[model samples]
Target: MEGNDLQRDGVARVLLWGAVLLAVAAGMRYGLLENGLLPRDCLAPGSPVAPCAFKTALVQSFLHQRLGWVSLVLGGLAFATAGRRLAWAGWLSGLSGLILYSYEPAAVGAMLALLVLARPRGEQRH
Candidate 1:
């Protein structure tokens, strides 16, 4: 396949934006325990109204932290590298985001990352 490689100019811009999202996710994962949308902590806590205490939550949160770090690294790589390969990395990163939602971030981050990956290919172009 020819892939999306016509020129590599857009990847860096995309990566820069993805980097911003990653930083945001990182901040939320490390700082926030509240989810405005959900009425309950799905991870469970000592009290229903209290923050999470489950080892599962702790583990998931750590995984999310790692995802943030990976996103940051991938963003830098995308910015530094050329061609559609960067887009593939971004696409993969987004897919990963969908799987990790600690601090309620991954869903939106996944969408944004997909945009970064697909924009140059007319998937998001306006």
Candidate 2:
């Protein structure tokens, strides 16, 4: 399959913007938690500080931090190259964002974007 430069550039932009948005969202979430603008535990009764148990919170925090970084890196690479193979990597990274970080919407959006960006095999320009 042969893809044109315009198609590649458009897909790359989508992936790049999606990646940037995901990173920004993660950072904003962290900032909100740090400043107490958002409650740590939504399940807890009113305004309790750090209501979540130590172990669960720790694991979740670790996962989110790691997945967020991984997603950013993968997204950046996809944006830089826009290779057809990188679409697969982007899908996996987006899945990690969904599973590990609980960023369902952004992860899903990235997944869809990657899917659209992937060029089909055996396609002919003519």
Winning candidate number (TM-score): 2
Per-residue lDDT tens digits for candidate 2, residues 21-124, read 55664554565445565555566566455544543453564364555455455655655565454655565556546544546443643554375464443443
TM-score of 1: 0.32
Candidate 1: which pairs clash?
none
Q: CA lDDT, every prediction?
A: 0.48, 0.52
* Candidate 2 ranges beyond 4 A from true positions: 1-64, 102-117, 120-126
Cα TM-score per model = 0.32, 0.36
Candidate RMSDs in order: 10.4, 9.0
| Residue pairs that clash (backbone atoms under 3 angstroms), model 2 | none
lDDT of 2 at 3: 57
For lDDT, the strongest prediction is 2
